[model samples]
Each structure stands twice: as C-alpha cells, then as structure tokens.
Target chain A: MHVLILGAAGMVGQKLTTALIADGGLGDQALTRLSLVDVVEPPAPAAFSGAVDRVAADLSLPGTAEQVVASRPDVIFHLAAIVSGEAEADFDKGYRINLDGTRFLFDAIRLVGDGYRPRIVFTSSIAVFGAPFPDLIPDEYFTTPLTSYGTQKAIGELLLSDYTRRGFFDGVAIRLPTICVRPGKPNKAASGFFSNIIREPLSGHEAVLPVAEDVRHWFASPRAAVSFLKHAATLDSDRIGPRRAISLPGLSCTVSDEIASLRRIGGEAVVARIRREPDPTIGRIVAGWPTNFNARRAAELGFVAETRFEEIIEAHIEDELGGRFVS
Target chain B: MHVLILGAAGMVGQKLTTALIADGGLGDQALTRLSLVDVVEPPAPAAFSGAVDRVAADLSLPGTAEQVVASRPDVIFHLAAIVSGEAEADFDKGYRINLDGTRFLFDAIRLVGDGYRPRIVFTSSIAVFGAPFPDLIPDEYFTTPLTSYGTQKAIGELLLSDYTRRGFFDGVAIRLPTICVRPGKPNKAASGFFSNIIREPLSGHEAVLPVAEDVRHWFASPRAAVSFLKHAATLDSDRIGPRRAISLPGLSCTVSDEIASLRRIGGEAVVARIRREPDPTIGRIVAGWPTNFNARRAAELGFVAETRFEEIIEAHIEDELGGRFVS
Candidate 1:
C-alpha cells in the first residue's frame, strides 16, 4: 500500500513513521511507497524497502497541497498543526496554517475528482472542548473552543465530516487527548506540562509543576495515539456513519495522580525531582480545558488507551528510555 | 443606528428591513443610515428619511466584503445564503456563497481593526442539526449536519464564535427553525412543503403534502423570525459568553397538527385544499431533519415563539393574510 504522512518531522509523526516502516505496511497491504512531508524536511525512515520521498513544504502555500496529493496515496495521515500556544500568540499565522492550510489540502483532494477517494486520517484535539465543561464530557457535547487552535481543529472536524458525507473521501478525525509522558523536551503548548512533569523527572532533571496537584486532565500515551491513527486509516467507514469525528478513549487523572505514578515506576527520587512552581498564565489556560470524557463511542469502535497513569509512564520508559529511566 | 442587511433582497431580509424601518431603529437608537446588499439589488425601504444604499454584490468575491464593511454599519444582519436544495445541488456555489462569503465578510470586519467591532447577527439554520435525533435535541447537542447547506452554516457558526471571542466582532448566530405559513410561493428547499400546505391553502390554492401526516418538525412564523433577528442584535453579549450560536425557541408539531391548525383557522374547506402527493425524495430529506429541540437557553434569554400550532396559523392570518383567509 502507498502511504503519505504530513507533519512527519514532529515527535508523533516520527514515531508513526517508524511504526509504519517496521510493520512494512498499513493494515493488510505491504508498503510499496511512502511519502513523508512537513514544513521542515522529514528524515528518511531507515531500513524501509519502499520508494520514499521526503519533501519540505508548507501545505498552506499555493499548490503545495496539490503537490502532496499528486501521489494519490491509499491512506493519508494528516498530523500537521501549529501548537496551541503558538497559535494563540500569532493569530494570522495560526489561522493561515491550521485553518487555511487544512482547507487547502482538503480542497486539493476534492479537485482530484476522478473518483479518487483516499482514506484520510486527521488528528484533531480535545482542545475542541473548552471550559465550563461537565464533570465528564459526553460524546455528543457541543464544541465551544476558547482558543484559536481549538477553533481551527473544530472547523477541521466539520469539514472532514462534510467531505466524507459528500463522497469526496473516506475520512476519520480522532480527537486525541493530551499525550502524556511525551518523549521530548518541553514545548510551547499550554498542555506541555502534562508531559514535562513526567519526562523530565524520569530523565534525572527538575521539572516545574505549573498547576496545583489537584488540577486534573485527560491523557493518552504517544503509543496509543499512533495506534489510533493506524486503526483510523483502516477502520470501517460504514460503522462510523456520517459523524466522522470521534473523541478517542483516554485516561483521566490529576497532577497528584501523575506524581504517584512517576514515584511508583521510578522511585521517590524521580518523583522528588518535580518542583512546585505556580504559573498563573498556564493555569488559567489549562483551567478552561476538559479534564474527563465519556468516550463511549470511540471505545466501542475498538480505540484503546493507557488505563492507568503508571502504564503511561512505563510505556514512555520502554519506548524512549530503552526500558529504563535515569534512576 | 446605522444598520446593514447583507441579503436585503431575500424574504427574511426584506421583512427584517421593513421591521427595522418601522421601528425607526434597532434597540433604542433612531434610524440614521441603512446599507442593504445582496447578489441582486435590494429594494429601498419606503418612507424612511435615513440614507439608504442598496447594492448588488457577491460577498465571496475579492474586495466586495471590504466595500460592504467600509460603511461600518453598527449592526449587520447577515441573511444571505443559497437555499438548502440549491446548495446541495451546486456544491461549489454553496461553499463559495455560504462559507467563503461569510468568512470574507468576517475577515473584512477584522481587518477594520481600531476596535471597530459591530454587532453581527448571523442567520444560521436548524439544518445545522442532523437526523436520528433524540426526542428533543438539547442546547449542547453536537452539530453533525447531513447536508452541504447545513455544513456551511455549521462552519459559519464556528467562525462567528471565534471572531467574536477574538474581539474582532460582536457576533451571535441564531439557528432559525423552518418559517411556517411563509408568504411566498414554494421554492426548491425540501422544507418548502411545510409552508406550502398552510400558505397555498390560505391563498385558495391546492397544496401538496409531500410526507406522512405524522412527520414532525420545528417551526416559527416569519414574524417570529424577524423578531429573532432584532432581539439578537440587541441581546446582551456578556450573557452569551464564548458560545455565540443559539438555538431559537419554536413550536414543534407534526404535519397532522399543522392541518388541524389549518382547519381551525380556515375551516374544513381550506384543509380540504391540501393534497396528499408524497414525494419520497423530499420525504427522505425531511426525515433526516431534527423534529424538536429543548431551546431552554433561548427561552431563558427571552426569545419567545408560538406555543400552540393554532397561534402559528393565526400569526399567518394576521400578518400575511390581512387578518382573513381566502374563504
């Protein structure tokens, strides 16, 4: 099977690329070609016996999306987006890249009109749900995003559903929870602390706890996120019906719970590495985010995530630390 | 108050214009200047001393939206959109007019900068909701529009909320129920029959009921619709928070209830004028529509509608039929 991966340079994209290369295919088809794209040139996956093409281009630019879709890959993984903090700070750039860029790609595919309907797997975010949320957000709750990034993702979900309903393409939008134990340095995303608190401690470094321990949030492992994308590409569209977007299953926990899990996996020393540093700006931004969700629809559709915070930490250690932490 | 109506040539637009002219202004302000725009040149409201400019322009085209916003009307009634059947049949035109046009206008207003935020009352539709619905769809129900028209309106609502939240404009999207006892002749909208059975019969003409009598739907009068726009323009945005879209309250009843109300208003002779010639295509389309809504939010916000089907029919007689039916 031919495959295309947008945003292939990002952490999740790189991991997804490695996973696809290792599997030698997606679903039941053997990989014959792989096209990877990002604003920056993505690295070539090592040891993959396929026709690989890596290109550095912005999808929002004129004709760039057309260039990406020209290959007519069987499945397209759209993982490109500006992080929340950057999008919030730069309004024009945010709308241009997140909203207009996505639309450009969708339109390009639509214009390919020779009945070429590829399976599109879009990465949406739980940020689509803003504050004043119920204790447990249900699958059918209204989306009233507070941030521009969330708004763009929400719009993308709408477009995906509409385009799929119109027979332009078979698409699935997975609203991923905050990916915890993210194996990377802290980023500018408002939700970055959810990962930094764990990743930094495991690496024998101090990490600031921006919010109170009582502050709760939803999470999924990077492994689970990649799995969600893989499953989405091959999932039965008939079962999904016209509602193409689904809130993926996730584990709900608080900062205290994360600390407890970190201590359990990496001893008290690692947990002690976390420093209490109150950052009101991040707190206020995170406060408006949803902490839990009743993702019954996604669970019933066979999407899975880490059940416990400990498991999430363990997965990170195994994947990023070669089965061990600094301790 | 300087007011602008984007689709001043359409039925709702014209009615809203007339109402605004008669009221002397919106809210407590007196009429100063009026700007009316549409793809066709709008008729000037009569007996108004205010400066009026009616222009034929397509908002989706370059610079058209900028020109419209140049006047910087205090309140903008964005009522332009191709009807459902037409939008669904002509895909490009629908997105261009409904989605792109609305976005262009919003962007134009945003570029006006200098804190020039106007009260933008956008006319959304119940089409934003899809079928296989609960008995009463709640205020927080997810938007999973099944038609292209519905999709466009849903996207517009997203843009409206985002733009409003960013302080670019003070916007409110009112999801209007199907206007019953409509004054004009039937158009191509699948929901056209809802008005036809009542409108044609009251005008001493035969009308076709395209679906079973048990087919239920939500509705309001053209008068109520106009009131919705006016109230939306003056409603306190502070109370609305970040979620700018609202489902307006309306009377929910079945086709049988409508006919029963017709009998009450125009006697059995008028009810007899209704012909049962079922068109399955329209029936299928209508079947996928929401039957009812729990518009408690709108009700709490003081948006009122007919409580009884008889009152809805009476409203038609009083407003459109000169207080008497053809009989």
Candidate 2:
C-alpha cells in the first residue's frame, strides 16, 4: 500500500509517520511507497526500505492539491489545519488553509475520475462542540462551533460525508480529544496547560495551572491518536454508513486526576512543580470546552482509548521521558 | 431602509418583494430603497413609489458580490441557490454557485469594514436532514446531509454562524420545508408530486400521485415562507444566541391528509382528476427525505406556519388562483 501523509512535519504527523514506517504496512497490505507533504519539507524516513517522496507546498495555492494527489496513494492522512488560536486571530488565513485546502484536496481526488478511490483519514477536533453542551455529548449532538477553526473542521466533516456518499472516495473523520503530555514545548493554545502541567513538571520544570483543579476535560495520548488514524484507515467503510464523522473515545477526568497521576508516577516533588496561577480568561475559555462524550458510535466500531490517566502518563514517560521522570 | 434580495425573481422572492412594498416597510423602518438581483433581471415593482434598482448578476462571478453589496443594503435576503436535483447532478456548478457564491457575498460584507453589520435572512432547506430521522427531528439534531445541495447549505449554515459570532453580520438561516400547492407547472424534483397532486387538480388538469398515501413529509405555504423571512429579518439577534440556523415550523401530514383536504375544498369531482401511477425510482428518492421536525426553536422565536392542510390550500387559492379554484 502506498501512503501519503499531509502535514507530515507537524507533531502528530511526524509521530504517525514513524509509527507507519515501523509497522511496515497498513492492515494486510505491505507499504511499498510513502509520500510526505507539508508547508515545510518533511524528513524522509531513514529506516524504511521503500520509495519515499517529500514535498513542501502550501495546499491553499492553486493546483497544489492536484500536484500532491497526482500519485494517488492508497491511504491518505490529512492532518493539516491552522490551530484554533491562529485561525481565530487571522480569519482569512485560517479559512484559506483549512477550509479551502481540504476542499481543494477533495476536489483534486474527484477530478481524478478514473475510479481511483483512496481511504482518507481526516483529524477533526472536539472544538466542533461549543459551550452549553450535555454532560456527555452523544454521537448525535449538533455541532455549533464558536471558533473559525472548529467551523472549518465541521465543514470538512460535511464535505467528507458528502463525497463519500457520492462514491468519490472512502473517508472517515475522527474528532480527537486534547492530547495529554503532548511531548513538546507549551504553545499559546488555551488548552495547552492540560499538557504543560503534566509534561513540564515531569521534565523538572515549573508549569502554570491556568484553571481550577476541579475543571475537567477530555484527553488521549499521542500514541492513541496515531492508532485511531490507523484503525479508521482499515475499518470497513460500510460500517460507518452515511455519517462519516465520529467522536473518538477519550479519557474524561478532572485536573485533580491528572495531578494525582503525576504524584503517583514522579512523587510529590514533581506535583509541586505545578504553580497555582488562575487566569480567568483561560478559565472562561476552557470552561466552554466539552469535558466528556458518549462516543458510542466510535466505541461500537472498536476504537479504544485509555480509561485512566495513569496509562496516559505512563505512555508519556516511556515514550517522551525515555522511561524516567524528574523524581 | 434599503433591502437587497439576491434571488428576487424566484416565486418566494417575488411574493416577499410584493409584501414588503405593500407593507411600506419591514417592522418600524420605512422601505426607502429596494434592490433586486438574480441570474435574470427581476421585474421592478410597478405599484411601489420607491427607488428600485434591478440587476442581472451571477453571485458566483468575481467582483459581482462586491458590486452588489457596494450599496450596503440594511437588510440582505440571500435566497440564491442551485436547486437540489441540479446540484446533485453537476457537482462543480453546485459548489461554485451554492458554496462559493455564498462565501463571496459574506466576504464582501466583511470587507465593508466600517461596522456595517446588516441583517441577513438566508433561505436554507429541509434537505439538510436525510433519512433514518426520528419521528420528530429536534432543534439540536445533527445535520448529516445526503445530497450535494444539502451539503452546500449545511456549509453555508456553519459559515453564517461563525461570521455572526465574529460580529461581521447578523445572520439567520431558515430551513424552509417543501413549499406545497406550488403555482407553476410540475417540475422534475421527486418531491414535486406533493404540490402537483393538489395544484394540477385545482388548475383543471390531471395530477399524478406516485407514492402511497401513507408517505408523510413536512410542508408550509409560500406565504408562510415569506412571513418567516420577514420575521427573521426584524428579530433581535441576541435572542437567537449563537446558533443561527433554524428549522422553521411546518405542517407534517401524509398524502391521505392532502387528498382529504382537497376533497373538502373542491369536492370529489376535482379529486377525481388524480391519477395513481407508482414510479419506484421516484418513490425510493422521496422515501429518503425527512418526514418531520419538532421545530421548537423556530416556534419559540415567533415564526408561525399553517397547521392544517386546508389553510395551506386556502393560501394558494387566495394568493395564486385569484381567490377561486376550478370546481
């Protein structure tokens, strides 16, 4: 199977690339070739003994989607999107890259017209659900996104379902939860604290807790996200039926639970590194986010996630911390 | 107040234009100027003594949206769209006109830049919902459109909400039910039978009933649709909160109800013009349409519709048949 990964230079994309290369295949088909695309040229895999092509091209540009899709890989992982903050800040840039880019890619495949139907795995976000949500958002809750990035993702989901219904391509959109222990420097995202408090403290650095300890949010690990992408790629499209968007399973827990997990893993010293600094702006923002989901449809389809935060922290320790923590 | 109607030549648009002229205003503001646009130049109102401008402009064309919005009409009714059947058949044309055209119009308003926030009444359709619907689809039901037209309208709804949230404009998307007792000749739309059965018989002609009497569907009169548009225009945006798309209230009844109403209105002689011919192709197509909606939100917001089929037929008789039907 030939694989193409868009946004291959990003964090999730890079992890997915490494995982796919190590697995040496997707499902039953052997990986014979790989194509990587992003705004920045992605690194070619060193370990993989297969044909690899890398390209640095902005998808928003005219004909860029067509050029990238010319090879028509068997599996396409579309993870490229402007994050919520940036998209909210620069509306035009966000829509151009996220909405127009995704549409361009879909249209490119459609214009191919030679019965070349590839399995596409698109990464949607929990941001699609705004404030005033049910305690556990069901598989059928309405999507009224408050942010531009969320709107773009929701639009992509609609298009994905429509194109799939039209037999243009088989597609699945998985709405991923916030990735805990994100294995990178903290960014400006409002939800960044969820990862920072865990990742920074375990690395012997102080991290600010923007919201209250009781504030809850949904979470999954980087490894789980990659697994979801793989699972969605190989699953029977008929099982998904018409609604192509699926809210994936994630561990729903309060900030207290995360702290407890950290304390258990790296002792009290590591937990003490989390500073008490309440920012109401971030608090209000995080308060509107979805804390839990039924995710019944995705679960029924065999998609799984860690039920306990301890597992998530352990994965981070083993994968990012090289099996050791600050304590 | 200046009002711009993008599809002023269509049936509902013409009715709305006439009603606005007759009312001499929308709500408290006096109608000072009226601008009409469509693929074909709309006819100027002969009775109204107001500044009337007519233009034959395609919104999908570059610079056309900018030119149309240059006047900055205080109330803009964006009713332009390619119908469902055409959109499903021609993918590129549908996206270009329905999706790109709407975006261009929105961006043009955003570009106006000097705090020009107009009240935009957009006409969405019930096509946004597909089969496997509950007995009564609620206001919060997720939109999973099966047709390309539905997909485009769904995208428009998302964009409308996002742009409204950003304070670029005050927008309301009214998802109109199938307009029953249509005045014109029968068309190729699968749902045309709903109107054809009643309309053709009243016009002294035979009408075909292609489905069983038990096939229930949602409906409203053209006059009710115009009223919904008017109500949506003058509504307090704050009351609407964040979600801008509304499933307008409509009468839900089976074909039996329609025939029974026709019998009471025009006697068995007029009903005898009906011909029973089952077209399985059309039956299957109509079977996939949404049968009902709760429409609680729209009702709460004071958007009313005819509850009885007799009232709907009376409306068509009063509005289109010169207060007389062939008996």
Candidate 3:
C-alpha cells in the first residue's frame, strides 16, 4: 500500500522511515510506494525497491496540504511539529506550525470529498498533560497543557477526533512518552536530558543532569516508537472506540532509577559520567510534566513499551553505536 | 471606569448593555465611557451619562483588535461570534471569527504590556461538554465536544486559562447555558425550539417541538446570563484560582417539566399550542448535549441560576412581555 509520511526529515521521521525500509512492510501490507514530505526535501530513499517520492513543502502554507493529499495515500503519518522549546518561545510560529499546520492537513483530507478515508496516524505528546496531575495519569484526564506546544497538540487531538467522527478520515493520535536514549546530538527540547544523560554517559561522554535526581518521568525507546507507528497504522479502528487519542504505555522511573540502571548495565563508572548541574529553566519546565501514566487503552490495544531502561540503552547502543562501547 | 462590549448589536449584548445602563453602574465602578462595537452599529446608549462610542467593525479583520485595545478600556466583555449552528455549518467562518478573532484580541492585549492588565470577561458556552456525560457533570469532566461549536469553545477555555495563568490579563471564561425563552422571532439555532416552544405558545402562537418530550436540557434566563457576565467581570481574581474558566449554574429539566411549568403559568390552552414533530438531526445534536450539570465552581464563585422552569418562563414574561403575558 502507498504511505505518506509528513515531516520525514526529522529525527523520529527518519527512524520510522528507516524501520519501514528495513522491514519492507507494515504488517501484511507491503510498501508499494513511499511518499516523504518535509520543510526541507528528505534525503533520497536509501536503496529502496518501492517507488519513493520526496516533496519539500510547509504544511502551514495554504495550498501545500492540498497538493500533498491529492495523491491519496492509504496510510498518512502526521509527524510534523515545531519542538516544545522553540514552540514555547515563539508564539506565532508555534501556533502557525503546530496548530495551523495540523488543521490545514486535516481540512485538506476533508475537502477531498471523494469518500476515500485514509488512516491518519497523529503523533501527539505527553506535553498534553500538565501539573497537578494524578500520580498515575489515566487516559481520561483533562488536557490542560502548560505550554503553547502542549496546547497546540491538545488542539490537534481535538480536531482529529472531531474530523474522524465526521468520517473525513480514520484518525488515531498516539501520545508518545519522552523517548529515552535518543540517538545523535542533543537539541533544544526541554525533555532532551532524559535521553542525553543516558546516551552521552553510556558513550563515555559527560552529560549534564539539569533536574533533581529524584525527578520522575515516563520513557519509551525509539524501537517502541516505531512499533507504535506501525501498530497504529494497521490496528483495527473499531478497537480504538470513539476516543481517537490515547496515552501510550511506557516505563515510569525517577532520575535515580536511570542512574542505577546505567550502573547495573555499564558499572559505577558510567553513572559517574553524569554531572549534576541544575538549570532552573529546565527544572521549572520538567516540574509541570506528568511523571507516570496508566495507559490502559493503549495497553489493551496491544501497543508495547520497554519495561526496562537497560534494554532501552542497549537498543540505542546497538542502533547508533554499532553495538560497541567506547574504549 | 470605561467598559467595552465587543458584540453590542447582538441580542444578549444589547440586553447586557441595557442592564448596565439601567443599573447606572457595574459593581461599585461607575460607567464613565462606554464603547459599543459590532459589525453593524449598535444602538445609542440611552441611560448612561458617559460618552458612548459605537463602532461598526469585524473582529476577524486584521488590526481591528489593535484599534480596540488601543482604547485601553478597564473592562472588555467579548461577546462576539458566529452562532453555533452557523459555525458548525461553515468551518472557515467558525475558525476565523471564534478561534482567530479571540487569539488576535488576546495578542493585542498582550502587546499592550505596560503593566496594564484589563479584566476580560469572555463568553464561553455549555457546548464545551458533550455526550456520555455523568448524570450530573461535575467540575472536572473531560471536554469531549461533539460539535464544531463545542470544540471551539473548549479551545477558548484552554487559551483563557493559560493566558490568565501567564498574567497576560485578568480573564474569566463563563460557560453560559443555553438561554431559555429567548425573546425574539425564532431563528435557525437547533436549540431555538427550546425557547420557541415556550415563548411562542405563551405569546398565543403555535410552536413546534422538534424532539421528544423526554429530551432534557440545561438552561438559564437572559437575566441570569447578564448576571453571569456582571459577576464574572467583578469577581476577585484570587477566587477564580488557577483555572479562570467556569461553568455557570443552569437549571436542568426535561421537556415535560417545561411543558408542565408552561401549562401551570399560561394554563392548558398554551400547552395545546405545542405540536410534536420529531427531527432526527436535532435529536442527534440534543442527545449529545449534557442535560444535567453540577456547576459547583460557579456557585462557589457566587453566580446563580433560576431553579424552576416556571421562574424561567416568568423571567421571559417580566422582561419581554412587559410584565404581562398575552391573554
């Protein structure tokens, strides 16, 4: 089946594309054609047998969504968004890219009016939840996002639910946890430390821990993220029921637990590589995030997340470090 | 103190302005300057001694908010919007007027950040809640809006809360129940029948009941609506707490209750004027609406609603019928 991946140039997008290319399929359906789109043209498909088309365009631009949607892909993966830090800093840019972009794409699919409903897999985030949350946030908690990025994602979830209810498209919004041990160089996302402290330290590089050691967070691996995308693409829509959005399952642990996991896996030397230097900005932002979530709906839907941080670290090492540790 | 009404030409806006004029004051603050704005020029203020400036302008137009905010009124009552039925029918119009217009006004206020924080009373609606609600929806129920109108209102509530939390403005969003016995010629609102069946029959005219007699709904009189706005405006910001939005108290009753109250007030003859004609479209919409809501927050904040449908009808007669119903 033909697949369209929006924001195909980004980190998660690149990983998801690589996974699809490596597998050559999602479930029983083979990848006959892959359409990749981003603000910058995506890298040429690496050794793909399937027909690959790359388009560079901004979804927030008025007509860009229509142009991309005209090709009628069977499955559409909407992964485009400005990161949390940047979105929170720039108000107009945040709403334009995160909110307007998602809406424009949904509206384009709606206006097609040909009764060709595609499966729309939307990438939401844990940012949709805010402070004063229950210890274990249930799937039914109210969305009161603290930042503009969270607000935009929450709005997108609402729009997706409504549009799907209207039969414009079959939509599913997966609220991804902070993907731990994120490969490659760190960026400006507030949650970057969740990955940085683990990935950098394991690679024999010193990594700064900006928050208190006791600070807790939810985590999933990059492998789990790809699994979610693939599962979301093929899962029976009826199983999702009426609520199109769900918080995905993940391992919940404190910062100390992460350090302990590192010690257990790579000894005390690896744990010693994490330097404690608190940044108040990051600390304040992290304070509002939910620490743990009970994703009953996602669990029931057969979605899986790494139960252990060691395995998460191992996955990152195997994928990014060629299964070798620094000498 | 200067007061600005954004939709002064609309039904509720005109009535609210009239009430403010008749009261001769808002809380203890005497009305010094009144600015009335609408797409059509609002009626001249007849009772207030203050200079009344009536301007015809569309809030959706660019730079209109800048002009309005430049006046730097002490209080802004934002009552502007395309109605629910119209908003649901036209998506572009809905987003333009409801979502973008609200944002523009907010941004304009934020830009005027010279320690000038005005009290902004935004009119939200009961549409923020949708189906599968508890028998009596509590303060913290999830906002799963079933219509475009509800979705937009829900988003507005989120923005109002966030902006207020950020100290951009002293804002409060009051989600008013559907006004019972709206005193005018019936229009296109699907909920119009709720008012029409009561008002038209009381006025010695036949009215059609579109849904079943068992369908229930929440309501408040136009007087209550004005009271809500006034209370929202004057409320101490501290009492509003972190979440600046509130669901105003509304009387919840069934159609039979309304008919029973109508029969008691105007006798059996008025009840006889009602004709049953079930329209599935309206039934579907009404079914998704919450019939009973426990507005604990609003009550705690000192806003009240009429308890009995008879009181609601009596309110209509006293206000619209000039203290006498048609014989």
Can you write out model 1's per-residue Cα lDDT over B54-82, one digit (the tens) per residue? 99999989899999999889999999999
Overall lDDT per candidate, in order of appearance: 0.92, 0.92, 0.89
lDDT of 2 by residue, B234-270 (tens): 9999999999999999999999999999999999999
Tens-digit lDDT track for model 2 on A1-327? 899999998889999999988999999999998999999999877699998999999999989999989998999999998888788889999999999999999999989989999999999999988888889999988898988888999999999999999999999999999988798887656788999999998999999998999999999999999999999999999999999999999999999999998898889999999998999978876776899999999999999999999999999999998998887
Q: In model 1, which regions exceed 4 Å deviation?
A: none
Instruction: Give Cα distance to truth, residue B252, candidate 3, Å.
Output: 1.5
Show where candidate 2 strays beyond 4 Å.
none
DockQ of the two-chain complex in candidate 1:
0.87
Off by over 4 Å in 3: none
True-vs-predicted CA distance for residue A175, candidate 2, Å? 0.8
2 or 3, greater by TM-score? 2
Candidate 3 TM-score versus the reference: 0.95
Interface RMSD of each: 0.7, 0.5, 1.5
Question: Tens digits of per-residue lDDT for model 1 on A1-327?
Answer: 889999999999999999999888888999899999999999878898789999999998989999999889999999999999999999999999999999999999999999999999999999998889899999999898988999999999999998998899999999999998888787789999889989998888999898999999999999999899999988999999889999999999999999988887889998888999999988988998999999999999999999999899888888999987887
The DockQ figures for the candidates are 0.87, 0.94, 0.56
Q: What's each prediction's TM-score?
A: 0.98, 0.98, 0.95
